[model samples]
Structures are given as C-alpha cells and as structure tokens.
Target: MTARVDSAPADSQAEAFKRLYPDQYYRRFLSQNTRPDGRSLTQTRPASVVLGVITSADSSALIKIGNTTVIAGVKLEVLMPKDPPDQGCLQVNVELTTLCSPEMRDNRPTEVPSFLTQQVDAAVRGSSAWQPQALCIQAGRAAWAVYLDLYVLCADGVLLDACVLAAMAALNALRLAPVDVTDAGNVVAAGNDAMTDGTSHPQQPYALSKQGTPLTLTCAVIDDRLIADPSSEEESLAATVVSTTVDGQGHVMGLQHAGGGVELSTAHLQQCITAAQDRHTDLFRVLSSAQPPDH
Candidate 1:
C-alpha cells in the first residue's frame, strides 16, 4: 500500500502562517523604529480632501488617507422631533461596499458599519461640532434633520478616522437654501428674491465651529511599540489598537481601544492623546485647503 499524505487547507495554511510569522515580520521593522512602508512609528500617511463631489447632496466631500478613501454626503430634510421640541437632529450612517474589500458584501448586514456610524455620531455629538438648535427652523414645528451618509470606497486601514474626516469636510462645505415658515406651520423653500443673485443662489448654511471640529488618530501597539495610523497589514498584526479624537483646541473628545492581546498603560494612553493633539493642526490645514470640486 502506498503512503498517503494530507495537505493543510489553503485557508488554514494562510492563517497558520500569519499566526506564526507576522509578529516576527513586523518586529524586524519596529526594531528600527520604522514600518515596512518606511514610516516612522509615530508617522501618519498623507491625506487629501475634495469637496462638492455630489451635486445632488446639499454638501459632499471625499477624503483619502494613503489608499483608504471615504466619501460623505449630507442631505437635509424637514421633520419634527417628538420630545426634543427645541433641538434638531443629526443622523449618520456608514457603509463599506464589497468594492472596497472582499470582507464586505453587497447589501449584507455587518456590525462594522453600524459601529463606525455610532462612533462618528458620538464624536460629533460629544463635541460642540454642531449646535442642534441651529438646525431647528421652528421649535416643535419644523426642523432640519441632517443625514450624513459615509461610503468607504477603499479600506487600507483607519476606517473610523477617515469617516470622521469626510463627515466634517462635507458638513463644512454645506450651503443650505433659506426656508420660510408659513402661517399653516409648513416649511417651504424661500423664493429667489431671498438671494441677491437671480441664478441658483447659495446661502450661508449652518456651519460647524472650526475650533470645535474633531480629528481622530489611531495607534497600533506591536511588541510594545506604538505606531500611528497603521496599515491594514499592521493592524492585523497588532496586539492592541487605540483610536483617539481631539478637538482643535486639544481636548480629548473620544477614545476607543480594540483587540485582545495587550493591556494599555495610563502613560501609553496619554502618549496617544498627545499624538492626536499634535495631528490636529495638520488635519485642520488639509480640511481648510480643500477646494470645492469644479462644476
């Protein structure tokens, strides 16, 4: 009888190799205080933003960090809140399409999208990024609900940070048409006379306080080395990942930690916060310089 040999399944083989070698592979670069992509441990990738990408939306922006791309669109709707008669509402949704990554499926439910949406909601709400009252056209009668939809066109890593950036940029570019409150308590679009120009006029929209704008920075811990804005491969090999958000004035807005490998120290947490603060200036500059897309 001939001896029979069984080979490991392809999936299992890949997983086994990742389990065995990724740490060593990453460590070789970490020992030099650098990443395989030639970035220093605390370095972040280049980022860019383009505004007014979607003509249909009240406002839209696309942001890219490294190869990760995210687009955010804002749609304004009139609605009355039941309990909060005085304040308006902001609803945020995030979607990762299959075109971005094989891990995501078309129209399939996933926790990641929901989690990202909630994270962005909390970040904006927790900070003074937007005043809900500004969206309220009439107390208890009618108010503008801003719906922010974020789509991930590419996923290199740092999904949450990218989403938040896109949302902020889109909101900054928003220009709302003036509305008139009728005697019947109906919200109607203002006439062309509302604007000095006869052409499709743009009105000064509800704007977010620039000083209150929030920026998020993500750090990955590998072999006790803290790396900022890790790539997808680095994230997979990380022992723990921490995401921290800071406002323009350097106040911590939100902090989140994931992965099960390592326990983070208070000192390390402070380092992450400091790094996020340092990144705020550069991020704000990028957002400010972002030009509206040419028609």
Candidate 2:
C-alpha cells in the first residue's frame, strides 16, 4: 500500500520563508553595504517634480520619487467664516488607488492614506508655511479656503515624503485670482473692468514661501543599517521606520517613528536628522526649477 501526503502550497511556502528568514535574507545584502536594489546605505532614490499638470486647478504639481508618483492640486474657494474666524483654513485629502498597487482597494479609504493625510496637514500647519491672514479677504467676513488634494498614482514606499513634497510644490505654484464683493455682499471673480477699477481690492497674487516649506525624509532601519528612502520590499523587512520633516533653514519641523523591531538611540536619531538636512538643498533645487515664473 502506498501512503498519500500533502505538501504546503507554493504561496504559503514562500510566505513562510519570508516570515521566518527575513533577517537573514536582508543581512546578506547588508554585509556588502548594499541593498537588494543595489543602493548603498543612506542613499536616496531619484526624485523629480513637474508643475502645472492640471490647468483647471489654481496650482498643480506631479512628483516622482523612484517608482512612486504623487500628484497634488490646490483650489481656492471663498467662504464666509464663523465667529472667531481670524485665519484662512486649509483642508487636505489623500487618495490611494488600487491601480497604484494590489495591496490597495478601489474606492476605499485605507489606514495608510488617512495617516498620510494627517501627517501632511500637520507638517503644513506646524511649519506655519502659509500665512492664513494673507488669504483673508476680510477678517471674519470672507477668506480663502485652500483645498489640497493628493493622489497616489504609484506607491513604492516613502509615501509621506512624496505627498509632502508634491503639496509644497503645488502651493509654491499657486496664484490667487483677484476677488470682488458685489453690492449684494456676494463674492465674485473680478472681471477685466473690475480689475482696472480702483474700487476693487488691490490684492496682489502671492505664492507660498519656498524657505518655509518642509521636506520629509523617511529612513528604514534593517539589521542595524539605516537606509534612506526605502523601497517597498525593503520597507517590509524594516525593523524601525523613521520620518523626519526639515525646513529649508535646517530646522526639524516634525519627527515620527513606527515599528517595534528596534529601539533607536539619541545618536541614531540625530544621524537621521543630519541626513535629512543634507538632502534639503537638492530637493529645494528640484522645486525651484519646476515653479512657473511670476507674471
């Protein structure tokens, strides 16, 4: 008589191998001071920004970091403020489409996207990047509400960093159109005649300051090696992930850490901050080159 046996499925076997031997698998590449993608420790992926991709939006930018791509659009709306409304309001929304990756679902708001939206909002608010008063048409009566919408076309990891950069670029490219209040107290777009009239508000268009914009840098810690801008595969193997936002003046605007694999020391944290500061110039150069010239 012959005995019948069942073996583990290929998918299950592969998953088990990764779960059991991830450290060892990653260590093989770390020993050579390289990553699976052939990038050295502390090396970041290539980044690029394109401005004015969406003509309908007041401002728009498309940013790509490695294979991850994020598009941000800014739209300005006039709103009547409630009591104690002294400053303009900023609203941010992030969408992670299933087309970007298999892990995401269609038309569903996932945890990652929600978390990224909050982080981008905090980064903007914490840095005081936009002067709310500048957006005010009339204190407590009327103000501009800025809506920033971010869409992830591809997610290869380092999502927060890409989103923040795209948002900053879009805001930098924004140009506010002149607005006028009618006799009936309704806000309307200033026509050519109104633009020439001295009675119209003499507000000049302005853009966000590049210096106040903050850039986020994400690092993945694997087997005691810190890798900058980790890929999706590397992120899966990471023991700790740290994201730090730095302004152009080298000030640390925000810091966040996730994962339970490793505890980072103060020195290690400082090292990450320094690395982020060092890369600020390169990112700023990309943003500057993509901005539209002022008319």
Candidate 3:
C-alpha cells in the first residue's frame, strides 16, 4: 500500500503570507479590537499532542500547536555528580533542525539551544517536577542524570510553549529501571527486578512532587493580536510576549514584552495569562490522551 501524503495547495504560501502581512497602510489603519486571524483577544491556537511515538526512546512526545511541531525525547544515564554528589541532575537540550526552518542551518551558530536550555532549566528548577533525591543512589556518590533532548522539526510560532509541553509529556511517559550500586559506589543493575532490569528501568516512588503544576503555556504578541501560539509569519511581523502558566496552579513563570518595540499593558498582560489558563485545558487533554511508553 502506498503511503498517503497531505500537503497544502501551491497558493497556500502566498495566501498565508498575505493573510499575515497585509498592505502597510491598511495594516497601520486597522486598529480593530480583534486579531487578523479573527480570533478573540483571549483565544488561543488549537493544539494536539502525542506521546510514545518513538519506539526506541525511553520517553518521547510530539506536540502540534497550529502549524508548529516539536518532538522531545528523554535519555537517562548514570553519572557522578560534581558539587552535589548526593543528587542526580537533569540536562535538557533543544535543537532546531535545519529541516524545520531556513534560519536553522547545519554548520551555522545557533543560540536556540542555549535559549531553550535556559528556559527549561528555569522551569525544571522552579517546579518540583523531578525529585533530585530520588535520583541519588548513595550519599555523595553515584546517581542518574537524565538527558532531555528536544528537536523542533517544525516551528510556526510559540516555540517555547511547544518545548515545555513536549518536555513535560516526555517526563510523564518516562519509565526507567532502578539502578543498583556496588560496594565500590559504582552504579549497576539488579537481577530480575522489573524496576531495574538493565533496560528502561524505573525505580520505586514513580511520582512527581506536588509543589507546582505539570507544564507551562506561552503567549505571544503578533501586531495588535495578542495570540497564544503564533505562527511563524505572525511571529516575524510583530512584537512578542511569551508567557507560561502551569495547570490549575497560577502563573509560576512567565516572560513578556520580548523582541523589542512592543509595550503590553498590565491589563493586556493579565489578559494573555488568562488566555493561557483557558488553553491549559487543551494541553491537559492532550497529555491525558497519551499512552504510557513501551520500553
């Protein structure tokens, strides 16, 4: 059987560009309360998420918010901690593949990874998503350091939101085996234990902390449209405000008035956060729909 292919018509690009970037004079004159996409000021783009799509990964997730798509994979490795020997660490990296966008090239320098890393680090640190104590095998000794890799195969708008959602979903899908430490303080595996069988092993206490919510939502500003999850063209043509609020819980982390030239009012900023909270339902549904990863 031949694989089915889906694609936009030839005129779609032109149409999209036209829709995003209207004539200069008209754009300047159109100071309507609504957005160009006909969405309410508090509406967010539609989002879909899938988990455990990758058969070989310990945990993985695919997120689609409007035209943007991102995949996040988690890999766990046991290594000795430097300063905090009793605690393991988590390293998160985000890569914007060349195929995703023209701006991301093969050999060129890209700050995307660093920026995303910082954001993820902040979120992870601020929230008690992963217990550092659980990762430790021995006091001032060996532990597990989880490596989270995020690849942006496509980015239309709101890359930060996609990244955070993907990361959280991956964390949820994770099921690692328990690690055993030898008398020499080296990490090893136990025999015949389901939680530590040398493959996709997860230890006991398979739970997240209750201090903070699961994920973050990002809101951006495109022209006069304060949109959640902006498309690439929309992102390019307007000042942006990226804000994220955890589910049920209030806003623990947020960044706004980014990329210069746009000053969002306190009222407008609150509107954006409120919009994100409404969208959080969609995010929750997507996460709830995913099945546990098969290791």
TM-score of each: 0.86, 0.86, 0.80
lDDT of 2 by residue, 196-259 (tens): 3244465566565545679999998887778899988888888899999999889999898998
Q: In terms of TM-score, how similar is model 3 to the real structure?
A: 0.80
Candidate 1 lDDT tens digits, 44-145: 999999999889998999999999999999999998866789787889999897888767756577798988999999987887757787777767777788
Higher-TM-score candidate among 2 and 3? 2
- Model 1 residue 94 CA deviation (Å) reads 0.7
Question: Which RMSD values do the candidates have, in order?
Answer: 5.4, 4.5, 7.8
Identify the runs in model 2 with alpha carbons over 4 angstroms from their true place.
1-23, 106-109, 192-200, 293-295
lDDT of 1: 0.84
Q: List where candidate 3 sits over 4 angstroms from the true fold.
A: 1-41, 192-211, 222-225
Per lDDT, the best of the predicted structures is 1
Q: Per TM-score, what order, best first? A: 2, 1, 3
lDDT of 3 by residue, 1-295 (tens): 9988887786886567577656442254336645556765556677777888887677788988777888998887888777776787888898888888877765588776788778876776666555787676665667777888999998777888888888887877776565666667667766555533233544453544434544666666656556566567556756666666565476546553467767777776777777767677677777778777444
Task: Tell me which residue pairs clash in candidate 1.
Answer: none
Score candidate 3 by lDDT.
Answer: 0.70
Which lDDT value does model 1 have at 9? 94
